[model samples]
Target chain A: MSAVATYVRLAWAWTRALAQYPASLAMLTAAQAVATVGELAALVFLFGHAGRLGGFGLHEALLVYGLAGLAFTLADLLMGSVERLGEHIRTGAFDVMLVRPVPALLQVAVEEFSPRRLGKVVPCAAALGWALAALPAEWTPLRAAAVPVLVASGTVICCSVWVIGACLQFVALDAREAANAVTYGGQAMAQYPLAVYGRDVARAATYVVPLAFVSWQPALYLLERPDPLGMPEWLRFAPPAVAALLALVAAAVWRAGLRRYRSTGS
Target chain B: MEAVIEAEGLGKDYTVAEGPLPRRRRRRVSAVRDVSFRVAPGEVVGYLGPNGAGKSTTLKMLIGILAPSAGRVRVAGLEPVRARTRLARRIGVVFGQRTTLWWDLPLRDSLALTRHLYRVPRADHARRLAELTEVLELGPFLATPVRQLSLGQRMRGDLAAALLHAPEVLVLDEPTIGLDVVSKTAIREFLLRLNAERGTTILLTTHDLGDVQRLCRRVMVIDGGRLAFDGGLAGLHAVAPSPRTLVVDLAAPAAPIAVAGARTVRVEGPRQWLELNGNPARVIAQVAADHEVADITLREPDIEEVVHRIYAGR
Candidate 1:
């Protein structure tokens, strides 16, 4: 079987095991739904008081917010289990993964693929749909085509960040929280218009982290607006390029970390 | 025959941080150093070592779980680290202390996933699983979640999971570390059968002397992260120089008997125990010539005693 097929099979096995605890799974799924809904409520409440956030109106900002959230949700669904690498390393479970014929990365990513995370997508996709319906921009074929590309590139970019962050667990097994600060924290930052942050902070997001390409750059193009920080116009279409490069870097980092692994004493 | 498993100058050095937060010191500790050995195909070799003697580290290097700090290792003609995935298809590993089976999934489900991971054909997988289940007595608990199985049952499941792909070589790290006597015996028997029927090359590290006595014809004793002794089991017994004890019942009570090839270590009412380092027959004959003997018995040192002596001396 191919790696992806094996991943799905492993993940499905876990999901079935999880389904054994129906009540707990239901409660967790409902909890995730409520949490995301609460976030959406807070965004709406904030926009109720102000006319616009960072020059984008409530609907415009919502488009950016929705796109970022959808991408993050998908990335989390696909690669969230990589966060458990620290626990696996601590308990020597990572060593078990290494001995398998399958790639250890695939094993780690699908270790506990929770279906509970699927709840977050409902609210995120709903928000994106609402924004698309409410926005006043003329729907050109090029502009309409950019939406799915934006989300795809954004999901890939977020997955790269997730994996690269997970690689740090190889050196500092206790640094899981520190890695989360960059990934989850970056997601929180990406869910907003870049104009709301200070000039240098937005610049860092553009060049250093490239999180701006996740939603802000493409959303600017989708909304037919000007760049607040005056980045190159070509960067709006550059998320795919950026995502590809980051994926390569993430793969390399993962390989290096695997080599550095110090398996625990039996 | 070509060696199925080979290691040349294999070593691992760990740089560990020690001391308090204010003044930490980094010390280089050698876990394994300049260790090398080989196992021919279909050979069952016992890898005996004390705790923390680099047994697991050596096994990990051979299985490609750890990249050796210095030296080289090959199993089935592939460098372990570079061709780990390829080598994995040829080698099966079981760590007695840990289970590779999914904790919450049923044993059968884990085995099914293993089938996919190793890309075994369904017909082959079913046949192998059936044979393993019968041999390991895993049928009753096949549907039970691994987390709920007893330690012995879980271990049986682990063994089956490892063997489902029918690897050419099996590397076991303490395969009988924790188990009831019956369970241990059963696992040992299964392993012996696996070797005999399939000609699978077996390398195992164990603290249990019974496992060594029953399964391994050749033994390698590692100490201080080095290959201290490697040869047949009889050679390992010779490393300790422990003597055989001879017990003789005399026709009547007498003072410590004078003998040429033996020394009287203990004396009782009508018997004496002599420590004999040479031919027991000659010593018994000499004692018989000096005095009438009722009966005699000789005891050789057990493998455990010889192994303990080796560890303590090292």
Candidate 2:
């Protein structure tokens, strides 16, 4: 069988095992969905009081928030096991991957498959749909088509950040906190309008972390808004290109980390 | 016979950071040094060592989990480091400290996953699973979750999981560490049968002397990151010669019995302890002929004593 097939089989088996505990799985999924709903409520109240923050109306801001949440949650569903790489390294459980014929990254990605994460997807997608229906912007055929592509590119960018965090676990096994700062922190910052942040924070999001490409830049294009920072208009279409570059860099870092790996003590 | 596994001066050094944060220093600790050995097809070799004696480190290198800091190793004619994925198809590894089977999944499911991972043919997988289930007595708990099984049952499950792919060489570290006598015997018997019937090459690191005595014809003893002895079990006695103790209860308390072939190490009111370097039978005969003996018992040296003697001699 091919590597992809094997990973799929492995993931399917885990899903079946998780299904054995239906009640707990349902509770976990509900908990995640409820938390996201609460966050959406907070956004609604904030927009209700202020009317417009950083020149983005309630529906436009909701679009950005919904897109950010969808991208991050999807990435988390696929690559969230990367967060446990530090624990695997510390406990020597990662050696199991080394002894297998399959790629270690694939094994790690499939090692922990959370069916509960499907819960967050429902709320985020609903919010995105509501925003798209209520927004006043012209829904041209090209613009309508760009939404899925942007969401996909955004997911790829978020997954790259997760892969990079997993790679860093090899060098610093206890750096989970630092890795979370980039992954979760990036997601938190990407949900807001880039114009709301200071110049330095916005620059870091664009240049240093590139999380702006995940939602903000694409939102600008889809919303037909101008760059508040006076940047080039072409930057709005850069998500796909930026995501590809980040994925390449993340793969290189992963390979370097594997080369330097030393299995934990027996 | 062709050699199935080979190592030439294989060693591993770990650089561990020491001291407090800002002033932390790196120190290199040699876990294994200049350890070289070979195992032929159909051979059962025992790897023996004390704690921190590098046995586990050497096994890790051979399995391709840990790359050696120096020298080289080859399993089934491939360098483990460069061809780890290829090598994995030809070898199976079991660490007694952990289970390779999924914790929440059933044993049968875990075995099925292994079959898929190795891409075993459907018919062959069925045959192998049946045979292993019978030999390892896995039928009783095949559907039970791994976490719910007993230690012995879990070990059996792990063994079956490892062999489902029919790996040419099986590398086991402490395969019988915590098993009860019944479980250990069952495992030992299964291993012996597997080697004899299938001609599988076996290399196991264990502290269990019973496992060594019953399964391995040849043994390798390592200490302080190096090979201390590599020969038959009898030859181990020569390297670390430990006296056999003979306890005799005399008719009455007498002067320290002057036996030529034995040394009187201790004396109680009506009992005497004699240490014999040569044949215990001859010493017993000599003592029996000279004095009236009530009861006698002999004690052979344990594995720990033999290992201790070897380390002390070094």
Candidate 3:
């Protein structure tokens, strides 16, 4: 079977299994939506006092926050289980995946698939739609096109970071926390204008992690704002390329980690 | 004969940490070293070793779960590590200590998932599932979640899941690790029938002697990261010191029983334990002619003893 088909089949099976417990699933999904809304509430309350964050008003800041939240949540929905590689490795479940006729990466990606994660999407989509309609920035065909491209490429970038972080489990075995620092922490860092964290942090997010491209650089173009770090204007269109390069790097790291894998004792 | 499973000097080296932090140094350790063996088609070979031996390492290399740090391995004419995904279609693996089935799903659902993962044809999957459910007796708990099933039931489910792909070769690790006699017997019988009917080549790594005695003709023993012995079960028996015993009950307490073919090793109140060197019947007859022999029971060497001898460098 093709890789996509196999992944869908595996994911679908898990989804069906999760559906068996309707009440618990509903409760968990409600909790997820409430959690996302709570985060947005904190952001909105901050805007109520400060009026502007890093020289961007409420809708402008919401645009960046929405794009980042949507991308991070999408990646989290798809590849969150990869973070549990350490647990699987310790328990030898990962070895079972290795012997299958499918790629281990694919197996790990779809593990514990739950539709409850879809709850996070609703608020982010609402915020992005509201911000897009309310923002005072001039809308152009090019800027409109950049929105989907930005979100898609950002999702890819976040997924790549997740895989790259998961590779640490093969060697360190307890690096999940360190990995979470990069992936979840990156999401937290991306939810505002990069300049809010100052110049050095902005440079690191831009060059080292490529997280700035997820929402910051592209949202700046949509907001018609100048680069806070004084970087080139063309960097707004750089997410897709950065995402592809990071994906290749992530794949290489994953292969190297798999090669270094020494399975648990029987 | 072309071997269905082949390994040439297959080895795995791990870098292990030693000592305390800051002063800790990494050391290169060989989990498996220079192990080579070939198994022909339709053969049930028992790969035996004590704990920490290289049995699992060898099996991992063969199944492509781990790449051998040195040497090579092939299963079903494909290099296991290089063509692991391709090779996986032709081999089924069961690690008795862990279940590959989804924990929260019912056994039937897990089996259905396996069918899709392996891409088994719908009709073939149905027929095979029916056969396995009947033979392994998985029907009663087919709808039970894997976590709720007993160990024996879970093992049967795991076996069904592994074989759902109709793999040409099956690799099982400790298939009967912890189970009651009845469950063990059921599994052994199922495996024997699988090999006989389908002619599936099996490389079983087990600490269970009964599993080996019942299902395998050829046995391989690995110790301290090397293949120590590999041959028939009878040959393994021969590697052990051949000291058969005859426990004979005498009518009265005696010093010892005098026999031509056996020597008295121990004496109780009314019984004598004689180590036989030749025909036990002749010894019993010789003792009966002179003394009142009440009863006699002969004991063969245990396979566990034979395996320990091999592991201890016999």
Candidate 4:
């Protein structure tokens, strides 16, 4: 079988096994959905008191939040198991992966197939739809076409960040917190307007980490809003390029890390 | 015969940091040093060592999991590290402490997934699965989750999983580590058949002397990151010459007995202990002729003593 088929089959097998415990799966999915809705509720309350925070109206903020949340959830569902690479390494389970004919990165990425993460996507997608309907911005053909591409780019960028964090396990061994900071923390930060953060923080998000390209900048383009930071206009079109570049660099780092891997003492 | 596995001066060094912060010093510890060996196709080689003897490290290198810090290794004519994926296709590995199968999934599901991962054809997979299920006796627990199976059952499952790909070489690290007598027998029989029938090149690192005695004709003893002895099992007695002990009971309290080929190491009351470097039967006859022998018992050296002597020589 091909690599893609193998991955899909493995993922399907995990999902089927998870489905065995219907109650726990349902409860976990519900908890994930409820937790994300609670975050959206906090945004609603903030918008109720203020017309707009950081020049983004309630609808525009929801657009960014929904897009970011969807991207993060999809990435986490697919690649969140990378966070456990350290544990696998320390426990010598990583040796099992190395002995397999498949690519280790692909194996690790699909190792933990959590179906509950899909629950978060439902709420995020609903919110994005609601925001799109409510926002008064012009719905041009080009802008309409860019929505799915932007979401895909965001997922790619988040997944790349996950890959990089997983690669760090070869060196750090205890990289959970660092990985969470880039993934979960980045997701939380990208939900709001980038303009609200300090100039240095904004630049870091734009250039260093590129979290802004995940949703904020893409949302600005989709919303047809002006760049509040007076940045380059091309920044709006940089998500796909940035995501591809990040993936390439992350893959290289992962390869280097694999080479440096001294398997745990059995 | 073509060498299925070859290593020349294979070694691994780990640089570990010591002490605190910026002033920490780096120390290089050699886990494996100047080790070299080759196994022809269908050869079952027993790699014997105590804990921390670098057996696992050498196996990891041969399986392409660890890159050697010095020298080189080739498995099936391919450099393990450079052609790891291709090498992986030709090799199957099992670590006794861990299972490659998914813990939560049933044995059948894990096997099915493995079939896809290795791209085993449907017909071949079905045939292989049936054969493994019957040979490993996985029928009862085929639907049972791996986590629920007993250690012995789980081990059988793992062994089957490792062989599902029909790998040319099967590298097992302590494959029979925590198994009962019955389980150990079952595994050994299966491995013997695997090697005999399939001509699989088997290199196993095991602490169980029974496993080595039953499965391997050629044994390699490693200690202190070096190969101490590598030869047939019978040659081990010569390398580590453990003296056999003879207890002879005389009718009365006897003076320290003297024998031509044996020495009396201890005497208590009417019994005397004689340590013999040569055959015990000849020495027993010599002692019987000299002294009034009421009873005589001879004890041969056990594997532990032989291994202990081997290590002690170092």
Tens digit of per-residue lDDT, candidate 1, span A1-266: 58878878888998999999989998998999899989888888888789787787889888888989999999998898898898998898998999999999988988889889988987898999998989788988887888899899999988889999999999998888998998899999988898899689788888888889898987887887878777777878788899899899999999999898898877
Clashing pairs in 3: none
- The true-versus-predicted C-alpha distance at residue B305 of model 3, in Å, is 2.9
lDDT of 2 by residue, B1-314 (tens): 66889999888898989999999999999999998888999999999988888988888788777778999898999999778888888888887888888988998999999898888899999999999988899999999989999999999998998898899999898999899989999999999999999999999998888898899999998888989899998888788887878999999999988888789999998899998876788889999999999999987666678889988887
| Backbone atom clashes (below 3 Å) for every candidate | 0, 0, 0, 0
| Two-chain DockQ for model 3 | 0.69
Off by over 4 Å in 3: B241-304, B311-313
What is each model's TM-score for chain A? Answer: 0.97, 0.96, 0.97, 0.97
Candidate 1 backbone clash number:
0
Please report the TM-score between candidate 4 and the true structure.
Answer: 0.90
Per-model TM against the reference: 0.89, 0.90, 0.91, 0.90
For A96-167, candidate 3 gives per-residue lDDT tens digits of: 999888899999999998889989988998888988999777788877887888889999999999999999
Model 4 regions lying over 4 Å from their true place: B242-305
Expressed as tens digits, the lDDT of each residue in A112-199 for candidate 4 is 7878988898899988899888868778888788889999999999999988987888998998888788888888999888887867
Query: Residue by residue across B165-201, what tens digits does model 3's lDDT show?
Result: 8999999999998899899999999999999999999
In candidate 2, stretches whose alpha carbon ends up further than 4 angstroms from where it belongs are B242-304
DockQ winner, 2 or 3: 3
Candidate 1 lDDT at A31 equals 92
Error of 3 at B171 (Å): 0.5
